[model samples]
Target chain A: MIRPLAGMARVGLRFQLAYRSDVIMSVVALVAQVFLLRMIWTALYGGREHDPQGLTLEALLAYLSLANLQAFATTPIIPRIAHFRIRTGMVFFDLSRPTGYLPQMAAFQAGHTAGGLLMLAPAVPVVLLVGTITPTEHPIGYAATLALGYVISVMMSLLICVIGFWTLETAAISMLYRLVSHFFAGTMVPLSFFPGALGVLADALPFKYMGYVPAAVYVGHLSGGQIGQAVAVEVGWIAALAALLWAMWRRAHRRVVIQGG
Target chain B: MAEVVRTLRLYWRLQRAAMRGALQYRLNLVIGVATGVAYQGSGFAFVWVVMHTFPAIGGWSLREIAFLYGLRLTAHALYVLPFSSLIGLDWLVREGELDRVLLRPLNPLVQIMAKRLGVGQLGDLLAGLVLLVVALPPLGPASALFCLAAVVGGALVETAVSLALASLSLRTWNTIAVRVFADDLFSKFGSYPMSVFGGAAQWALTFVLPVAFVAYVPASVLLDRTGELNVPAPVAYASPLLGVALFALAYRIWSRQLRHYQSTGT
Candidate 1:
């Protein structure tokens, strides 16, 4: 089991490197995204007369910048893999494997995900460049929380893509998911602008676990207690979702065997 | 002209089929609607958030901005739902499906687009209606007329532009990049008042992207707001002319591209 898993993971690395052009384009796209978000956040910060509820413009900018870079780097791997399998007939060949389907795919994807770290490769320099251009008092305490935030974002994306086990419309699902996540989780802009009661509600949603939490950490916005709870929720979500995903895959596999889908 | 009508009719049939196909998956359809609502809701949420940060954007108040946004979404949905394939034009082109469309009777461009209506449009329309209601205080009867002319007219023009992009798909091997590039650019343009971007950005939006006519013109009148950014009130009243002009151009382009379309072997 270990050897086969290791071999599959190794193959995933080769698969990613072979598509170097795609990797470069993806990195370029992510860089464009970083610049776009930074500009938008700058505009938003410009609008702020005061950081009521304790938001500093620099902290907010750093939060957004880090979250943008981290999400671009760590996530999107599952949707990428799931889309190819469904669009082509590779799922059939994969089922012929002795290994469990999703775990194998996840392991394979973990290797592919390394290429995504290119997004983060430029993040520090750009943030420093951004810092020099406009000083924002970002604290170091935010680092650990931001790390947990990456975990949350990747786990949520995996949970969402696991829906592909049951649904064939992965593109539509993925598009909708990304749109909602970007909006509700403060990926495009901060969620602070949401109305009072609603802002609270938005923060409560798992959607924020994707973008807001990371930004929250980057800006040192989360309290130690809040960080603890956030990590706990993220871990709990991963466990609960992993179980749900396994159950969904089993149900879907039953149908696949019966109908050969 | 006859080809246009025939293409529209074929498009209607394909639209019906697409709707039926969507309806067949009831569970998927329900989730899809929810997803769409969340998707659109996020954009509105972004606007709501931005407004909180700034009292006004370039003299456009929250209600007035909402009015423009409402018009923007309505026009966008009206065009996009009916010509859904515009975004997917590259795929259709690359797959050699455009040749099947070109081989058909009536306008081949119409044949290509007739089947392109996206059902998620219903979500956009409903969302726009709610926004219109919210924005009603700033709007008057004259503004309503402008909104009518602008949104309905704008949808037509936008659809024509989409069709024009589809036409490009025939010649350009990569229509997908165009779709992505265009959509990304317009998403930002559509969300904000074009006037806020300065004269150059505004002009580019009006003549180059054409989104300004869709949202800004009608929104200006409806919001009862005036600035350097507002479209001349007359432009809002006759927005449909823009759509007609674009549609004619798109048709001409499609006809030229069709002569070169070679059918694919599936």
Candidate 2:
């Protein structure tokens, strides 16, 4: 089992390595986004008290810089995988293979994610030097939270992708997903700044688990109690989503109907 | 002169047909519009959150920011509605679909632009106007005129910038790359107030990208914040010039591509 998973990981790395051009595109996007956002937040907090929720402008910029770096890292490859499966009738074909479907999916995703993290190598140095930063108070703890957040996000994202199998029309769902990610993840603006009812609502959802929570934690927004609570909720949500995904995939396999070519 | 008229007339007919096709799925269209509203509507919510945090950005208060938001949203609607069709022209060009468009009596560039109207964009238009109504503060007559002119100018700039970016795919082999870059460029910067950007970045938006013409400059005029830009007051008032020049240039460049079009039939 471990060997197959490692093999799959190797396959993902090789595939990602071959995608030289696409990787370049994403790296350019990451840099442009970080720099541009730095400018916006600079204006947002310039000469003013950016002390809302204890947010220093420099910390917020660093948070955003890391947010952009992690944006694509948490994707559920299951959507594209689902697209190919449906188009090729491979969901049933996969059932014939000698492996647990759920683990198979997880292994493949982990492989892809590992490759993506490897690609993030370029960002580390940039963040160290060029990227705006808050003084690192709990660098190791922050890394742990970020790592856990990536895991939770990947699970939830895949859970959403699995919905593609059940719902033929994913356009609206996709739009909602993209839009939610943009705003809730602190990609648009930090959650600390959100207005009354919506702000409270934004806090409860797993949306912040994608970017904001990790960022907030990195910059010391969540205290020890608050961090514990958030991480607990995130882990609970991840488990719930993973279970739901497994059940749905099994049901979907039974209902699979292939049309004539 | 005649060419412009004919081009406009053809695209108008194509738009009507496109609208009818879209209208066939009335429920879907309604849902699509609802989705679009929800999609953009959340930004206001997020902006509201930010206001609560800091009260104002770059000296613009929450209410004033809302006004800017409306202007920006409306500009985006205008950008999407009439010229959303221009977004896919690069795909047509890359696929050699232009050959068929060229064979017709009408100019291929115009025909290609005329084809594939996405009426779903009107949802964006309606949402924009609705936002404008909700966001605009009570203003005097002069500011009102300025706001109106800004909306018009913003729309023109957005369309021109979008189409110009689309035209780049004609000469460049990377159509999707250019297309994605165009959408991201306009949508990202256009949402925020210009003051949010630094001096060099602001200049790029004003002179280079001109995305700020989508809402920032003219709205600033109405809001009485001309000090934002180091440029003279006239430059802010003349925001429409970039849009006009760019739109005309896009079509010209697209036309020039017709001379070298190697249709896929080959």
Candidate 3:
């Protein structure tokens, strides 16, 4: 089981490496985005020592920069791949293979994520040069929550991909999901900036674990107790989403139809 | 002039066919437009949230910023409505699709653009028009007319930029990333008041990318904030003409690059 997963991962890594130019361009774009966000935040702060959200400008910049980097690292392509395979009637071949489709996909996604992180190394220096980052006091806690966040993000993305079994055209749906998740995840602005009821809604959703929680933990916005709670919540979401995905996959497995000749 | 009119009429017919083809995917078409609206709406919502916390950004009020955002989005929609198919230029070039395009009597650019009518951008147009109606300050007849002209002009500027970048695909270069990056720069920075950026960044956006000409200069003119503009008031007023000029130049580049195209011979 482990050997096949490892072999699938190698295939995924090779696929990613084939798009080296894309990785370089993505890194450049990420740096530009971090710089743009920095400028916008600085302009909004207007040289003020204090902020309404109770964050200093540096802290806010740190949170945003880290969030952007994290978002870049965990970019999901499984849904896109699934949609394409299903649309092109390639899923038949995938199913005929001895390995389980879900596990194979998960391994491929892991490998793709590994490639993204490797490309991310170049952008880190450029991001640091863009602005100051608030060092996290609890590095171990930050790492643990971030790992949990990555798991939650992958599971959520796979859940969306599984829906492609029903709807062959998942492109628009996936795009909509991305836009909604990107906002609710606090990649654009901190959930702390969300006013009253909106804040409550963001909190209620599991999307926050994907971006906001880890970044907040990194910038020391969350207390140790809060980090513990976030981890617990993230684990809960992972279990629930995994169960839902398992059930959906079973249904999807029975319903799979080859579309084109 | 007669030749030009005939070409345009033919172009219109081709575009209608493309639209009909797209409409066949009824569910995809509806979802695509809704997704476009939600995409642009959520972007503006982020700004709205930011405005709630901070009184203003770069000395522009929320209403004024919304006006600017609407103008940019409307122009973007207009540009993308016709030219969205050009985003697939790399694929077309790689697959030697241009070999077929060159056999047509009309201009290749028109043929490529007429491949599809972007349904998603229709939603952007809807969202932008609503914002313009809600956020626009009362204006004189001339100013209103100028706003219409500015939207067309801004669309031309965006078209010019993308067209020029996409021309690289004619040489079989994979330019999707760069093209997307350019689009991102426009949507992200073009909505903001230019004064918010530092001098070098502002100058680069204006002179290098010409993103400033898309919506910022015209919005500044309409908002009566030309006094704060880096360029003179006359330059701001004449900003629309820059679009016409840039588009003409970009078309020349496309033609020149097309001459260098080599078929993949698959």
By DockQ, the best candidate is 3
State residue A215's C-alpha deviation in candidate 1, in Å.
2.7
lDDT of 3 by residue, B1-266 (tens): 99899889989999989989989999888887888889889989988988888888888999999999999999999999999999999898888788999998888888998988899888999899888788998999999999998999999999999999999988888789999999989998899998888899899899999999999999999999999878899999999999999999999999999999898875
Estimate the overall C-alpha local distance difference test score of candidate 2.
0.70
Better of 1 and 2 by TM-score: 2
**Candidate 2, A1-261: lDDT as tens digits:** 777666666766676667766666676666767777777667667767536567777777777876666666665555566556655666665556677555666667777777777887876667544456656666755666677777776676566556656664455666677677767777757777776777798887777877887777777766577777776787787788778877887786666654325
Q: Best to worst by lDDT, what's the order?
A: 3, 2, 1
Error of 3 at B69 (Å): 0.5
Which lDDT tens digits does candidate 1 get at residues B1-266? 87567656777787677778788878766666666666677777776777676677656678877877777787777877767756766777677776676566655545555664466677777787788677866446775565677777778777776777777666756565555556555555675666555567568778888877777765665555544554665666566678778878877887788677665555
* Error at A30, model 2, angstroms: 3.0
Worst 10 residues of 1 chain B by lDDT: B221-230
Model 3, docking class: medium
What DockQ, on C-alphas, does every prediction get? 0.37, 0.53, 0.74
Q: For candidate 3, write residues A60-165 as lDDT tens digits.
A: 8999888888888887888898899999999888788899998888888899888888877877887876857856897977898899988888888888778888
Displacement of the residue B164 alpha carbon in candidate 3, Å:
2.2
Indicate the residue-level lDDT of A101 in model 1.
70
lDDT of the structure predicted as candidate 1: 0.66
For residue A252, model 3's alpha carbon misses the true position, in angstroms, by 2.4
